[model samples]
Target chain A: MSWRDGIVLSLRSVVRRPARTALTIAAVALGTGLLVALASIAVIAETRVIAQLGKGGPATAITVDANVVDPAQIDSDTPRLGTAKPINAETLRSVKQLPHVSTVTTVQSQDVYVLPPPIGSALSGYTGDDPDRGLARPYSDSAIGIDFKQANNLPITVLAGRLPAEGSTSEVAVTLGYFDHVHLDPNKPAAVLGQVIEIGSPQVSPDGQTIRGRWSRGVIIGVVAQDLGSGGLVTSSTLTNAQRAWQLAGGDGNSFGLPLPASTYSSLVVVADSLDTIHTVRSEITALGFATTAPEHLIASVQRYLQVVDMVLGAIGVIALLIAALGITNALLAAVRERRREIGVLKAIGAHDRDVLRWFLVEALICGVSGGLIGTAFGIATIAVVSHIVNDYLVSQGLLGVDLGGAPVATSLIGVAGAAVLALIAAAWPALRAARLPAREAVGAL
Target chain B: MLGSDAVARGVAVSVRGLQHEYGRGRHAVPVLRGLDFDIEAGSHVALQGPSGAGKSTLLSLLGGLEPIREGEIWIGETRLRGLRRGELAEYRSRVIGFVFQHFGLLDVLTARENVMLALSLAGIPLQQRMRRADEILDDVGLTDRAGHRPQQLSGGEQQRVAIARALSSRPHLLLADEPTGNLDEESAERVLDVLERLRVDNGCTLVVVTHNPMVAARATHRLHLREGRLAPELVGEPA
Candidate 1:
């Protein structure tokens, strides 16, 4: 029979068994929907990260370090300074002078203490200097650092006041928790922003000896209102002020020797001119003996993880699709049996064997295509449901700095195409059964 | 004016020394033994017999739906007994029309659609199959019922659609197995009239197998079958 007639006839036949058709369609939808949802999460996660990284700088950029070496042993050699190295200003200056260096900055974190009866008897408040200021208070007992300009580029949002000036030794910024711990009276005009506070050094060394260190007093210029919960803190200043404070806090010469070698910052943020330049810049930096990468590379790494996840998900989905296909095959075979007397009648009336074969095959194709369309729609709705949960988790955890709706375009397209392929795959066995039926045998089937 | 040789020369279907047996060895049940017949083109014939006389089986062999066990059966130049399965199918599509007692119109299709399927399977062009389907339905008195599916039509109407489908390809021969066996007298006469007119209009050789004497009486000739062998031919009243 002509393809059109075959299609029409087949469609009509499928429509006759409404419940069976609906069940098959639902089966496809379940598989496709789960696949689409999982895929969308992966895409959204990648999108959020890349957006953050891109905001921080260009795509092709690198940080250079003279003391760059394996990080695993840096702690054993230097004692537990709490996990990150203080990259020296001289090293940063040298890299700043390197060719194609768009911008360069330095930061370091160290411990300090804040005095005055501790809030709720739980040790609170951070006393630290900007890495560029090098002002250290050994008494206050908190994380302190000279914040690089890059810190302002951080994904964290500021709640109140303003950023500390480029070279201001008279100011400091504290997270919202820092203010909470000090028990400072917010109603008192002088207790909140612009409040002058005395900062002191910590009580003892890692060896447990109470000893004197450096101290400084500065006004609070900005308060980061986020409750980061991780207790990470930052402070910043100009390069010259940082040098003076370093000298005051026992740093010697441009090469400050530590109990171990002072290597480099724990992580580096670099910006390249464009997406295309990221690879070239990364390779160039790698040649210079530094590990380097960009947002897309990190994204690719995440995608590799997603690929494994998808395989597991797809395997699960395929089983469901297969079950649906078997159902369709069963129904079609049943149709063949029930229609046997009719088949005999047709053959008796000049209907050829091929006519019967074509009729049944057309029926199968109709089921496949219809099920595919239904499944695709279901998958998109599924993605929407799952993405809501995933996005909420990300926002609540601060992983995603902002809420993004649904998923990217490519992710949705992949879902639809995948469903269509699955439907066609499921139709093969039934189509074969239909195409091979002999007129005599088929007529006898009943 | 015509002798048996002239009549045999005019035959659209000829079967000689036909034999059919089921199974093998000790279990072989002979179904047909040495049957012979010549049906002239444009003539209507009815085969009458008891249930086990192999009326259906003989019709099947004659229509090229089954292989012959022995001897020869020919429809025009295409050898029904000697042809391969594919060639036989092609022959059937081009030369034979069939109407079963149960009226085998596809239940899912409208009357017009059922007729179109036959023309389509015969390799008629897409545009022409529809028109031919319409014409055949009209000729079978099913024009007013074109849009009705098999279940929606009466038994007589369903059988009419079946006849339309069978003849839509304009086959050279019509093979009916009790075309009126399932119908009441009024419906049977109506169906028989349609079949007679179709045979005349198409110059088709028509064969009907039935136990109904009235149906047999309308045939141009009658063949009495007893256990698959044809009795001496009997002249029947014309339709």
Candidate 2:
């Protein structure tokens, strides 16, 4: 028979038995939908995790510390005096001129005492009283200073307002950890923006027994996620101005009697041209007598873990499809049994065994393709609803939300093709049984 | 009894020492035992016998539905014994049409689709199959019921639709096994009339197997079987 005739016959047969066909199609759809949904979810999860990691800083960024000459001790943020050569203006210029080195930002930090707004102020309602201090009191904190012109290199997620203005010495951005330390509600961090706080530089008394504060007023412009440095972030000039003011007030040195270096920075953040150049740039920085650390190694470990998760989810989807294929085999076998007489009539009318096989196979193909299309649509809808709910929760928790845009086109096509091939395999035995049936016995003529 | 024009337009059947059996190795039951016969092209013949007399078995062998176990049967220039399974299927499509006693109609199809199925199996294209199906249905007096399914038609109409399906391909031979077995007297007469008219119009050989004498009486020649062989007295007799 012609292919058109086979298609028409198969379609009629499928439509004639509504309940069985519907049940079979529904089984296939559920299986395929689960497969697509799980696969898409895995892809979205991998992308979101990588994006979250990226929020800290570009994977190519390397933190260079002066006291850490060994790469093994790269993570130490504090400077150890007399260990390695300190990074200064010369160090910054030398690192910037290295191959693949895109830019460099100087970092410095100082201990400061912060005094929150008093009761009945704009932020007083959102701030809780410390058990040791009645309402508002000075608390010891650290302010990390970096070049605001190269601020993009910082690993920070701003939760409210903008970063401290490039050249504004009076502006500062506090970390979420600082809000928690100061008894401020991190969940409502926007309330703290625009509030003024007093920052004091520590100085030793002439009697050599007590410490006094050299205070300056600054405005809280933004709240950011915790990163490599703690407390608040400011322009390098801001911390330098505070330190110079303390020195001009007859303070000979810090509480430890160590002189502050006038020309050198505590550390330097070096940005590479791309992730491909991070390792080379880091090695060059380390060769310059400084320790370097980047996030590439951590990213690689995370990727390996996500790949395993993807494989597990894919296995579960394939298992579900196989079960659905079994359902298809069962349904087609029943159809062959019920249509024995019809098959006999067709053979009597000169239909070949191949013709019979083609008709039934066509029926199976229709079911598979229909189920695949429907299941793909169902999977996309499921992802939409799930991402919406998850994003809502993420936003409420004061974090960046995830965007999971349906499965990729290639993934969806593979899923549909997989369903179709499995269905064809499932229908093979039943179609063969129908094709090989003896015409005489099938028509009950003998 | 055959004319030269009918001989030119139809296929003649010759059977020599034909034999067919069911089962094997002592459980064997021979159905057609050394039967010999010749049928002229364009002539209508009837095979009448009691139940289990191998009437339907002989018809199936003639229609190429079963392989010849030990026999030589020829239709036109084609030998049934030498033909392979695929060739026999082609022979059935190109040379013969069949009508069963139960009015073998696929219930899912309309009357027109049922007729078109025969044309389709013959590898006819869709447009021509549709046109030829309509023509044959009209010839069988089923044009008005073309859209109705088998369950919707009466027994007489269903049998007529079967006849239309058989003739839709315009084959050289037509075989019917008890074409009127399930019909009332009037419906049987009507079905027989449509069968005879379409057979003459298509100029094809017609063979009918029936237990009813009324059906046998309508044929130009009759062959009566007893105990798997043609009865001597009724062999080659005119009805």
Candidate 3:
């Protein structure tokens, strides 16, 4: 018979028995939905973990710290000598010109913020700034002076306002904890945008005994999604140190040519051209007498863990689909038996055995495709619900540099198509059984 | 090579030393024993036999449904003995069509769809299949009942639908096991009349396996089967 007639006839046969067909379709759909959910979970976990690691540094970028020689290590009984030397300008210039080093962001200088209601509110009027707020414990954390040229390496999600503008000395994006300590909703970072805060900026001299700079006022412009832990604050890159702090803050407009040297940098963020060469870049930086920090190894471990999870989810989903495929086999087999006389009549009218077989296979295929589509939609809904629970937990745990929200659920089209193909494969046995039945016995008897 | 006029009058069916048996070993029961015959093209021939006389078995072999165990059967230029299993099916689709005694209509299909399905099996295109099907249904006097499924149609109507499907493809041969076997007097007469009209109009070979003397009387020639061997054909007035 013509393929067109075969398909139409198959459709008619399937539609003639609605209850049985629907039952089979529902079974297939259930299995497909489970598969989709599992695949989606694997995708979400891998994406979030990668994003979290990127916050420390881009997966391909390595931050190198200058090595300092301590006198105590040389002479154990000589007591203490001093701290290590920071990476110098010559070393910074050397690493920047390395092969395959696409771009560089020099992280020069670190600042301290006297976080109000600090670690523990003791109501002790230590600063006498807000005496009524006694236990106004002061919070202290390292604020990395960010250079906007390399901001792409940071996995920061802006929750409220924009990031500290490229050249705006007055704008600074602080961590959510800055507002959290004052009992305001830190989640609503936008509310604090343009608000002024008195920052206690105490700088230790080279002798490490003297302090400089009094309380400096800075305005909040952006609120990031995740806390940089030690509550990351990206100060305006234009104002890197106390020397240029006043001028860049738009107060004096002077000292525009002063360069912040790498000697005072907490650490430098160096971006490589590709992830595969991150190890080479790290080793190159180490040869320059500096310790390198890269998240590539940690990310690799997470990827391996996610692979196992995806396999398990895939296994479970496949098991469900196999069971559904069996349902199709059972349903189609019974249908073939019931339509024995019809098969005979068709053969008598000139239907080839292949046509009879194709009709059954096509019927099973229809059931599979319809079920897979419904299951995929069901899986998307499932991801929506599961992600809601997950994102809430991530928020409550104060996780660093990971916001699992905003990314849509990942639906694997191939997974759904696989379910359909598997169902057809399962139906092959019954279709062959129907085809091999003697047309004489099936029709001539009737 | 036969001329066009000779090919037109070429033997429609030729059976030589045809032998068939059932079961095996000690349980073997021989059916047709050394049966031989030649049927001219465009002729109505009826085979009449009592119950268990192997009339249906002979028709089955003629339609290529089964292989002749010890003899050769030729239908026009094609030999049925050497044909592959798939080739047999193709031969049946292109050259042979059957109308069963029990009115073997697919109950799920309407009277019209049954005819259209036959056209489809004949590899007719979709656009013209329905129109041809409707014409055949109209020929079998089932135009008003085209949409009525087999269950909804009466026994006479179902038989007519089957006849319509058997003739819809306009095959080279029409095999009717019992065109009027399951009908009342009036219905049987009407079906027989329709069969004769379609056979004459289409000019295809007609072979009927029947038990009724009246059906045999309507044929141009009648052969009686007794104990697996055909008796002499009783020739009627020449068409």
Q: Write out fnat for all predictions, comma-separated.
A: 0.43, 0.58, 0.52
Q: What is the per-residue lDDT of model 1 for residues A346-416, given as tens digits with 9 covering 90 to 100?
A: 55444555666766755655555555556556666776676677555644443433443565667667656
Which candidate comes out best when scored by TM-score?
A: 2
Complex DockQ, candidate 2 = 0.52
For candidate 3, write residues B27-100 as lDDT tens digits: 99988888877788888998877877788888888887766688878788778887876787788878887889
Instruction: Tell me the tens digit of each residue's lDDT in model 1 across B108-216.
Output: 8899988887786678997798788888888988788999998999999998988888788888888888889789999999999998898899888888988898988
lDDT of 3 by residue, A296-339 (tens): 66667878988999899989987898899899999999998898
Worst 10 residues of 2 chain B by lDDT: B1-10
Give the lDDT of residue B220 in candidate 2. 87
TM-score of chain B of 2: 0.94
Indicate which candidate wins on lDDT.
Answer: 2
Clashing pairs in 3: A68-A84, A118-A137, A118-A138, A118-A139, A121-A135, A122-A135, A123-A134, A123-A135
User: What is residue B211's positional error in candidate 2, in angstroms?
Assistant: 2.4
**How well does chain B match by TM-score in each candidate?**
0.93, 0.94, 0.93
Worst 10 residues of 1 chain B by lDDT: B230-239
Candidates ranked by DockQ? 2, 3, 1
Docking class of 1: acceptable
Candidate 1 vs candidate 2, TM-score winner: 2
